[model samples]
Target: MAIEKKTIRLLILEDSQNEAERLVSLFRNAGQATRVHRLTGIDDLNEALQHSWDLLICAPSSEALDPTEAIAAIRRQAKDIPAIQLLANNDSDDITAALSLGAQDALPQGEDERLVLVAKRELANLEERRGRRASEVALREAEKRCQLLLESSVDAITYVHDGMHIYANRAYLELFAYEDADELEGMPMIDLIGASDQASFKDFLKNYQGHDGHAELQCNGVKANGHSFAAQMSFSPATYDGEPCTQVVIRAHSGNAELEEKLREISSQDLVTGLFNRNHFLGLMDAAAERAVNAGQPATLAYIRADHYASLLAEVGLAGIDILLTDLANLLRSHFPGEAQLARFGDDVFTVLLPGLSPEDCREQLGSLLKKVESNLFDVNGRTVQSTLSIGVAGLNEKTAKAQEVVNRAHRCADELSEGNGLKLFDPADELAAAANRGSIVAMIQQALENNSFHLMFQPIISLRGDNFEHYEALLRLHNPQGEEITPLELFTAAKGAGLAEKIDRWVILNSIKLLADHRSKGHETRLFVHLSSASLQDQTLLPWLSVALKAARLPSDSLVFQFSEPDAIAYLKQAKAITQGLNELHCKTALTQFGCALNPFNTLKHLHLDFIKIDSSFSQDLGNPENQEALKTLLTSLHSQAKLTIVPFVESASVLATLWQAGVNYIQGYYLQGPSQSMDYDFASGED
Candidate 1:
């Protein structure tokens, strides 16, 4: 079970590069050569795992990554890649718990002697597991399925064991003129043969032994009532009930009579693309996955989806896109060379496998291919339809070792990076670095939320009321290392891209609670709102984090309003509904942000009894424009008539306030009141309103 290699590619997700380097040296000295990449943040982890690696060494206990979180990320990306947690203790209980947390082994970080031994043993186990997965591929095809195709044909078939009739299919019994199945089962092999053919049949049985592949013999069979009939019988060696047996196919006439039926029985390939259809493709994908594991090679499939293909189909018609798919398929076959097993995955997506390749090979080739594919374009009916291939590549490579997770990760990356016509590859390591930074940002954002670098600035909410002190909204901000101030939009966008979205949302919620506490303590408690992110829409439990934060601050949910952006709010409406219902139970105020812009969740406000609708600033930008102004006025009147809802119009300029107020907008927010501050905790320049 020895790993066959010079050394395994390993990575250390340690914030300390020195510690990572020391382990790298130890692995090299211990007969394992490797290139170790060090991860200090969650963002760059994706880059690290876009390929395969032998192992990942992590120290969540040393504040590098929380062991559980890191393990989840590892399983998501490199499922088969083993992870070893460097524990501070050699205690058995700690080791057992680490194993349960998905760590392959827990070894003391500064140890000598057995460290190399432990690494070797884990590597061997990894290889063995990979081998077992490989060998079982052929047997996974359903036995009943094979029997169904063989027995259901309208042809004579009799199974012979040691020259005695073991069984006969219904077609075989019918052709023999046997009264029933039992009459066919117990009869001697010679009984079915014509009396004149006994000697020749014996020769046929003897010659067919140990022979493989196709052969047929012309013969005569004795039917019931002593009738003789001419027939052709085909013999093949096959396994039945764990014993060797001979398959006999006898027809009333020549074998040519059954040739057309045989062709129908072998139906599999997809007709349109001339590739394996769905059932066959899935079986092959499974086989390829097992083969990769068995052969100890990295495996991945590319979900090459044709972006904007639907619109192209609409414009150019089906015949054009059909030729386009055909041309694209030919391009894939040529470009991938001899590496991948290609298949049409239905719709505009096609799948291919690069099986039994090393993790390094798998990664290098996919990366090189992505760059090359950037310039490749497709032509539809002589029209160059500027179409791009947005691919989601998933595999048994380090970042995508499992079947389902690989698919999910690839889809997520493709969807997020669709702005570019070129391929955008993803590795979880990229997300891990950003996630790691979120823990630090959470602490910093909470403390300085109301201070100079972080304070709540008032933006005027102008509507029918002129510059009313009664209404203003709060925003969050951050300061970069370069002494440049960053808004919540910038900070949150990076976090969302890096998958630190949930953590950032948590930080905003907890800090917002603290802001409410400050306002209540100063006897200036007013409704200050914080916007919820689309990513946070999935986190139903984050609402409970606020309950604890509010209790800690000795404030009620009534002092705060939870604002949901229309897009995020509408995307996962069920999660949003559950969240809203929970907040409604707490008597907390709820409002929809960018209300007019959200097409889907815009409907939620009418049915869910939503409290307020923030007129999206797009209406403000186009207030003077005739088309936009009419749309905004119509929307304001309709929402007011149906719900008489409080409308907080987000105006970006003092110039637009008078026009917006005359347009029937109630509350307005603009630079006239002041811009958003860095803090969620402090209300800056109270007299500005």
Candidate 2:
């Protein structure tokens, strides 16, 4: 089957981040961008399963998780995510075990072509199953609506199976002068006709059984009161409650315009919140996008999510949650008034589209609304539940080409918020820049590499204690012809896509070594932590090349600490373990940035030897929250227990300094001390707190 979707939402149960990327790259290379989340344990798996996922690829069993348990979790959630086990070494026993654990297929880890093949097949099959389920649900809903219309309909209608009355509407009962439908349910169609017309009615029924279209006959009808009346009866093939039957309508003059109108109204409305549904709202979004792009109109789309929704679910049962959502919806309706399209995106999530409004205007409106929601106490089941909102706003301006893309950007902004009761406005410039420069980015990168124009900046990783250690993390930067800076994220993403990541990594490493050696010559035992791309982790010759470069610069290998993201190390666990081992042999230090992001971060540590571990910047960024502060303290204790020096980055204020000191963090880096600079001039000996 051909893969039609441009994006695939994937969940990987692999502990290694490099391996996960390998799977993701397969989809990317096949023109399918992926939104992937790697699961490290059952908890991570369970949390990720809350969202819709296309595929699950996991190791048969790892120290962090079991594939069987992951499958069980998916089942427990009643989600239709397809699971496939990626086997190590392709052992027959492992294959048998993985299949027995309910994996769709067990395949070797390195068979890239075959893996894509099976994944596509499974994705296609999953789509078919979801489609079938949706159709089934639609059929059931349609049946209920039709039954409702039949009951309220003015025309006298009855259903007959095998010449015996199976069902009769209220109109039919009243037309036959019966008090209730049960009195006519078991009665035969022939019994309802007068004796004078029974023969003709029997003939009409017999002929209509062979006929596919409707047939009508003028007949005398006998009521339950034994009174006869001239009536026109129409017969047509129909199904009632899954059984084949013939519908008989008497004097059917009125049509079903009212029922159709009711169906249309409900189809566009959400039953829970009484707001416009997702499908209808998306149509409005598309129209807004078109207006923004073609008619020069500007609109703002806001994605609002109720914070701590899972906790709220625990506080209120499903029915109560619905009531709370409805209350929230009503508040939104009142706040927006008219012309603003409000929709229930999903459970506890709402979307508001403000037409003819700039993002700034929208932000102001949302800010006011945010305060109202935060202060207002919602009543659910006679209990008060106060919840905050996280709103992400994006402008549907001339640059907005796709409504879905705008939705994704707004959602991403909301998800990126560290705290609740906050609003984030998505900057469209970065997205526009990336797209506008995609064609020239590779050329710019090549020019930078050939001309040796790439430059590095340093940010001091200061010690929380009064130690005289000068440490900085090296940051890479690039400038285009317009003198605009391109972030390392954008550069590396383009480089990897263009297959220049390895060359770029080598360039950064060589330049970093030279700069560190020069900085140390000034009688400063300065140490620099340089980031390496995932490509460099897989480069078997990187260690040997680094050894030559360090010797050439006459710099001690330990002074130039090499750092890669935790995700990179996890994705290429085997290579990371080997590279770290090789670096250790060369007396070099290695550190993992974005550490503690994995489900079992320590599980990756078990495979490699590293001297320094930098906690993910989010931990430092969200230190204001007590739970985050405690989590950071606990993580620091664990790292210290392992004899590993922990570095906390993104320390932007004095407020977190006391916590870091109490947590015993070795080093801290952020704007609070000093921002990145061309020179390593941070006065570490100043003794400033």
Candidate 3:
């Protein structure tokens, strides 16, 4: 619904400009907004046919243009426009000839009312043909994507029609101990399950209609070798090879102690710095708050933030930042003794809980630690990078009943402090003001949504290799009442807090698809990478809604790549996997953005099949360092080995280009290429090697 009404692009084959204007005016009189392009000769007609048009109107009696030749030319190009021929006189022979030449309808010239009616009819017919073609293309693409996903997925997957295996992926064939897909071509669905659960599965399948489909069961799976293993099988309704079928996904269940330990570590520890994650840190803060209220114990929480963190990231990259944080965490661990907790509280910010410490003592300890951090030159890939930290202290007392309140206060004070000050104590007034400011932002987002005031910006994703296609990442921008653009971070935070993230995502998807479709109609092979929020990933209706949107826009499924952050995909692994699978089934591509930072990044990839892996921007910061460059090369090699394309972002310098190119990266993007712009005008061909 983003594009409430469609504008018809009409191509007119007429020697006289005045005649073309007159025809266009008739459509306008009928309440249509027509964009008309008049062709004076065959050369112009041939060039114009490359662009998309809703309808083609030709004056048959023009001296320079022959109606039969024009219709034949349009047909030869295979352009799906409803061609209407205008005859100066109603000669039955001429009319029949025009129809034979592929004209949809022939009308007499100067019959204004009849011409308008015929034009509207032809335009409606054009829309219908386009819609039908789009749906057919989408269905075919969906089947292709499904095949690719199944082949690449680590889990065993197969499609069953009438309880017989019609298709199986490599993983399924290998899992069943079969050498190839042909070995399991006609296997019954019940043969893979244990005898005990066979009857129950049959009963379940008898009532399955895809509407009540998604179900998982634990059962013993029998391999081709007759060995049985405990497996978890999930069933979902799917269509494969243009036939109705059920898709079965199986994963071996293991009770390995090491895997459990790794899972626990991932849940509690930050993958980069090996410190407590944000959730675990908040839990510690809550316990500290309870102790302060119940036992009357004094505690202080210090929020440490890297000053100008964005600039530092651009300078050193994620690997460099990781090294800096690891060294800083070591210093904090040594400086603070037992009963003190340290956490990497998300994105260049660290938190420390000091129990049994007075407010003045907490400030004194934190100030000394800050000085130590500032004075030390951290070794980031053999390059000494000097950085400063800003600290904010908030004391827990009997009056502080909630831990989040204390955390918010500390963050507010940290934001208020200047870089020169480097430290600040939490002020109650600042907390109140911050709350009021957040409330205002939430209201602004709601108003903007109501007014349909959000817009999209694009940044080019340049290919390191010679890829002729133009690719861009679509970014959302919102305008406030003052008509100034609000940053995406602020806008998303407000939308999430207000429980409107899903709505915002839907808006972005619809508008981006419409815009991409229109752009492609202009003869550009453009692809858009649209980011989705966690809410959209978890929404059950998103896939079906996306199908309708794509069909209406007539855009190819592969043209729009849906992306989400690595952390979101990991945190909501089940939902993310389901969404990704569904997207694959719909023939759309998927990308995991801000990747390579998780403790076990590849572990998530093993469960969900993806087409593109966007290396976290952190990796781009220190590519100048040979050590960092080697690390990046190794990561890209691993990903390439898995048949996954790699995209590295934040390429700000020419020096880094050689490193990324030599690393065998598939795509690279940064301000050096171009920043986000309102238009998709990046000269991809000019940058081609």
- Candidate 2: where is the Cα deviation over 4 Å? 1-439, 687-689
Q: On a 0 to 100 scale, what is the lDDT of residue 30 in model 3?
A: 33
Candidate 1 Cα RMSD (Å): 26.3
> Compared with the true structure, what per-residue lDDT tens digits does model 3 show for residues 514-605?
89999999999988999988789889999999999999998999899999988677657899999999999989999998887655679889
Backbone collisions counted per model: 23, 7, 4
What's model 3's TM-score? 0.41
User: What is the alpha-carbon lDDT of model 3 when measured against the actual structure?
Assistant: 0.82
Per-prediction TM-score: 0.35, 0.42, 0.41
Best-to-worst ranking by TM-score: 2, 3, 1
- Where does candidate 3 clash, by residue pair? 316-621, 316-622, 317-621, 318-618
Candidate 2 global TM-score: 0.42
lDDT of 2 by residue, 1-689 (tens): 11443367889877777667767765654445678998878778777777788998886457788778888778777788888888767789988877776788989876665777799899989989989999999999999999999999988999999899999999988988999877877888899888988887788778788889888888788888898877878889999889989998997323465885788789999999989999999999999999999999999999999999999999898898899999999999999959999999988789999999988987778999999999999989899999899999888989888999989989988987878889999875545445446647767788778779888888998877665558988888898768888865557767776788889888888888888888888899888888877788888999888888888999987897888877677667899999999999999899988887665789889999999999987688667799989999999999999999999888788998888998899888889889989989988877463
Two-way TM-score contest, 1 vs 3, winner: 3
- Number of the top-ranking candidate, with lDDT as the measure: 2
Candidate 1 C-alpha lDDT tens digits along 1-689: 11224457776877777566657755543324477777655556666667777777887464655666767787787568788888888888888988998988888876633555577777778888778777555455556666787679887887788898887887887787787878766577887788778999888778888678767988788877777888878888877766788888886764465775655434655555665555665676666656665665577666677777788789889788777777777777777758577777777877776676543455556566555555666677678765666766555743334565555666666676666444445565544434435544433443343233454454434335433223346565666434556655445544554465666566667766766577567765356667777677788677687777777887876766777766555446787888878888887877787676433434667445466688766567756687877887888888778664456454556666666666677666655555554433334345435
